[model samples]
Structures are given as structure tokens and as C-alpha cells.
Target: MRFKPLPADFYLNNTVEVARQLLGKTIVRNYGKKILAGKIVETEAYIDKIDPASHSHPGITKRNKPMFEKGGIAYIYFIYGNYYCFNIVTERKGKGCAVLIRAAEPIEGIEYMKKNRGKTKSVYELTNGPAKLCLSFGIDSKFNSISLRSSKLYIAEGKDENFDIVTAKRVGITRGTEFEYRFYIKNNPFVSKSK
Candidate 1:
């Protein structure tokens, strides 16, 4: 099926709202001649200043520069000496806010995703977390700061399916625990975590 990327304006909305609304969107990655796609099942939002857990809270640097760019771009980062996490920059330029793509339900190019992930025992294990999603999609630093409008990586429209959304506190952070910035599709097996 043909996939059309979301318009640039879609990313200009509030980070938290974008994170929640992204639950059913399709994330498409063009890997060579094949197309790898997944339905976004989980997301986390981080806003500058207000969000202490946000990387941009420390201000723009070489590492977090992408988070300050205009909305509709990628803000990928590495952590724990390994693993890449993919995020979509949101709001206006210099806003330093974004929605992290925490998990996705593999839809297209399952074989390619499995090959990239290497020996996944179940389909749910493929793109069920931020790092896993990036690994399955072959995303890394090279993809950072690029336009999501590009065919290489983009969030496309998904099938019209109704699903309840769940909101919870962001995970893997000590600060900003008071804010419930994480969102996921209710009962989605591909969600990174359910709580």
C-alpha cells in the first residue's frame, strides 16, 4: 500500500498532544529497495524548560542540537554506550521539544526488520521499545537532524482504526516523574511497557 507522510504542520502541535495522537500513525523507513513500516504504539513527550528530563533542558549542544531545530525533523540519540532512540522534533524552531517514538507495531517489511533486529523470538520483540525500534528500522546518528518529510524516514498516515489511549509517567528517568508524558495504545502488544 502507498503511504503518504504527515504534513509538516502536524509536528507543530504541542509535544504532549503530539505524543498521544501519534499512537496510530505509521512510521516508515526506506531501507535500500525495501520499505519498513510500523504503527506507532507508544510515545513520550519532553518539553524544554518545563521538562527536567528533557535533553534540551541543559541547552543546545552538539549532542542535542536536533531537538532545537524546526518541527518535523528527526532527533535521534545514543544512550548507555549503545542503542539509538528515535524522536520527532516538535513545536517551532528553537523550541527544544520533541516526541520520542518509544515503540511500534511492525506492519510492513517484517523480514527486513527481523534481519535488522537479529534473532527475535516473536514479532512483539522486534520493535517493542525505543532502542529496539531504532535498531529494527536501521536508525542511528546519521538519521538525526534530517527532515521527516524525506522518503528515507517519515511518519505516514495509518489505517483508520479505533484504539483507546493510555497515559502514564515517562519511564527511565529520575526527574519529571510528576508529569505523565508517556502515551500508548491500550492493550497494544508492541508497547514498550504497560502500566
Candidate 2:
């Protein structure tokens, strides 16, 4: 099957709508050593100015400059001093909105992902969380603000197996506890625990 990257228009719209539509899409990254890919099973919408819990709540900075870029760009950030959280910038340029890819199911280069993850043997842990999958794919701040359509980081359409969609509050956040912006494929084994 052909795996062309989705265009900017695909992400230059409503974040919630994009988040729901992203399910089952393939996220691929080739780091020279190996190619890692997975089917996105879960995502969360973060409308910066509107979402209290979004990192942009205070204001934009060097850390969040990527989020303000045009669509089809990666807004990767580091957390807990070690983990990297990846977000795809959405909407028009200067619109501080993004879709947080919460979970993915490994689909390509499984052995490479396992090697990158070191102790991960079960498929469940290969691409379950944002940090986990980034580690498995070798994504870091180096990818910050990279364009998805042209960069090594890209997403493609995938199989559409019937799945139940569920929406709930985003986890691991102290603010916007009432927004209930997180969404995941129901009964999916790959959804991140912060559902």
C-alpha cells in the first residue's frame, strides 16, 4: 500500500475533529538506523488559549514556539527531565492548537522498536504511551517544529477496523480537570493509562 503523508489541510482544522479522525492512522519515523511505525489508537485535543491545562495557558515561549507554527509540524517537548512528549501542530499558522498522540499500536520494525525500548518484549508496551513510542522511534527535541509532510516524521492512512470511540478527561494534569478532552478507542489495548 502507498504511504503518502497527509497534507497540511488534514491538520489545519478543528483539533477535536482531527483528534477523532487520527485514530488508526499510521505514524512513521525513520532514524537512519531503522524505521519505526505504528497505528495511532488514541489522541487528545489541546486548544491552547481555551484549554486551561495546555502548556500555553500562561503564554508562548521558546518551549512552545512549535505549537504556533503552521499545521503538519511536530511540537515535541521534554517532560520529567527525560521523557519526550510529542504533539502534532494543527490549525492555521499562529493558532496554538495541537493533537496529542496518546497511544499507538506498533505496526512496522517491531524488533527495532523492541531494541530501542531495551526491556520491552510485549507488544503492549512497545508504543503504548507518548514517551514510550517516541523512545521506540528515536524522536526527541531534535524533531521539534519539524514538518510532518516532508520530514522523516510522517503519518499515513491505515486500516479501519471497527472500533468504539470513548471520550474522557485528560490525565496527569492538575488543571482543566473538567474539560474531559481525552479520547481513545474503546477496549483498545494500546491506549495510554492517562485516559
Candidate 3:
């Protein structure tokens, strides 16, 4: 199927708004000869200096340089020395804001996702978290700083459906926890956590 990536302008909005609007969108990974995709179910916004939990809070460095790029690019980072978390850069360049793709519902290439995740008990467990979603989609540091407008990966439109969105505080962070920047589709089983 022909999938068009969201325009660069789509991610130039406020980080929190971009995070909320990402729900129900599809993240596509062009893996080799196969195509893997999922409907975005959860996201978390991290704003520059305003968010102490943001990697760019300490100012741009080699590791977080991708987060400082213009919007509509990938800002993948490794965590706990085990897994990679995928994020989409948002707002203008130097703003250092991004939207973390927390979870996604498997929408295409289920077999590929199952094999990548390895030994998952069910489909719900395949891409229910940021790390799992990255593993299942084969996303890593190599994808960081790449333009999402075109390449091996991109975010596309999902099936037409309306759903309620739930806003909650960002998780897995010790600082800036008071900001309600996390957003997810209400009652989505694939959401990593519900508030």
C-alpha cells in the first residue's frame, strides 16, 4: 500500500498538541522487503528547558543533538542500556522539543512484529511500550536524526475512526512529573498504561 508521511508542518505545532494529535496515526517502518506498521495509541511530550526530564534540558550535546533538529525528524535514544525509545522531534529547530511514541496498536505486519518481539504471550504485549515498539519495528540509533517525511520510516494516516483522548502526567520520569503531557486514546488496550 502507498503510505504518505505526514507533512513537516504537521509536527511544527506545540509539543503537547502534537502528542495528542498523534493518537490513531500510523507509524510505518520499511524493513527490508517487508513493511511494518502500527496505529499510535500513546504519546508523551517533552519540551526543551521547560521540561527537566528532557534530554535537551542540559543543552544540546552529541547524544541529544538529534532532539535539537527541526521538527519532523526522528530523535531515537537508548535507555537502560537495553532498549531504544523512539521520539518525533517537534516545534522549530533549537526548540529541543519532541513527542515520545509511548505505544502503538499492531495494525500491519503482525507476523514480523511477533518475530521481532520474540516470545510475546499475545499481540497486546508486542508494542505496548516505547521500547517494545522500537524493537518490534526495528528502530534504533541509526534512525535518529533522519527525516520522517521520507525514508525507511514515517508516520501516516490511520483508518478513519473517532476516539476519546486521555491526558495524563508523563511516566518513567523523576522530574517535571506535574506536567500533563502524556496523551493516549481512551480505553485502548495497546496503551502502555492508563491514568
Candidate 4:
């Protein structure tokens, strides 16, 4: 099958649905002369303000404004004041929901990723964690609210990602890591260390 990006509706409907659908897709970031892209292997969903652990529960702000936008846009935010976390806004306009890209396995632009990361021995460090992947690819707060189909940081089909998706509890959350919202490829070595 050809790699066709799902419509904006695919992400604007629900966070969990968007998360599940993103299991085998590709995330591409075009940085000037190079395009750093990869196959998505891990993700977690944030449903609504009542979810207890969602970022929007505390009310929207200049920082989380991207999440309230229409879906299919990047909502990159910094966590822990140092880690850059990547998220995709979900639901129609005004919904403060999104799917967090927990981790990814590099599938394209190897040398570029390596150069950006300044390492070559291990591929895991290139894109294993959300913050690590963003840093390697130049994704930052400036990319927030950008279209998911933009020429700069859009997502597209890269390679075939057919397989059974595995579901598990999320990690690194203070209140809701037990909801089983994490989704990843079953038995895929590149899924993540915890998988």
C-alpha cells in the first residue's frame, strides 16, 4: 500500500483514536536542506481535562495554546524545563487534547539524525525518547501549532508499518500511568526500552 497521510479528521476526532492510528505511521521534519523522518513506534493519549493527568486540566495558557487548536498540528512543549516533548493536537477546534509521541525508531535520514545528535555508535539514543528525538530533529516550541501536513514539519507515510499494536500503561505520569493508554508495535525492537 502507498503511504498516504490520514486526513486532519483522523487526529481531530479523539486523542486515543489518533494515538492508536499513529502506531505505524511516519513523522517527518524538514529542516532546510535535510528531512529527518522516522517511523512512530510509541505513543500515549491525553483525553480531557477530567483525565486527572492532562496538562489542560489546569486551564489553557500561552504555552499549551497549541493543543487547543484544530488537530493535525504539532504541539511541541518542553517538559521538566529541559526536555522537549512532542505532541499532536487532537479533537476539533477548542478541544485541549492531544497524543504524546513517547518514542520513535529512526527509519530515515540516518546521517542527519546522527549529526544532530552528535553520536554514531548507538541508534537508540537518536530517537528512543520523546525529548531526545525532538532535540535530534530540531523540533521546539517554535513548531507549536504548525500544520502536520506542512512542508517544514509535516508527517507522512514513509514505510509499511503493518502489525499488531500492543497496548500498555503509560509511564512518567504522576496520576494516570495505569490507564493503559500507551500504544506501540508488538515485539518491535525499536518500540522502546520498556516495551
TM-scores for candidates 1 onward, in order:
0.97, 0.94, 0.97, 0.91
Instruction: List the candidate numbers ranked by lDDT, top first.
Output: 1, 3, 2, 4
- The clash tally of candidate 1 reads 0
Q: What is the C-alpha lDDT of each candidate?
A: 0.92, 0.85, 0.91, 0.80
Task: List, in order, the clash count of every candidate structure.
Answer: 0, 0, 0, 1
Q: For model 1, give the RMSD to the true fold.
A: 1.0
Residue pairs with backbone atoms closer than 3 Å in model 3 (clashes) = none
Q: After TM-score superposition, what is the CA distance of residue 153 in candidate 1 from its true location, in Å? A: 0.7
Please provide, for model 1 over 90-139, each residue's C-alpha lDDT reduced to its tens digit, 9 standing for 90 to 100: 99999999999999999999998999988886899999889999999999
The prediction achieving the highest lDDT against the true structure is 1
Q: What is the lDDT of residue 115 in candidate 4?
A: 83
Q: Model 2, residue 163: displacement in angstroms?
A: 1.9
Give per-residue CA lDDT, model 2, range 1-195, as digits (tens): 357677669998898988988988889887686667888988888998878888766678888888888878899999999899889988988888888888898888888888989998898988888889889888888889888876588988777588888989887788888887788888888887753
Candidate 4 Cα outliers beyond 4 Å, as residue runs: 1-4
- In model 1, where do residues sit more than 4 Å from their true spots? none
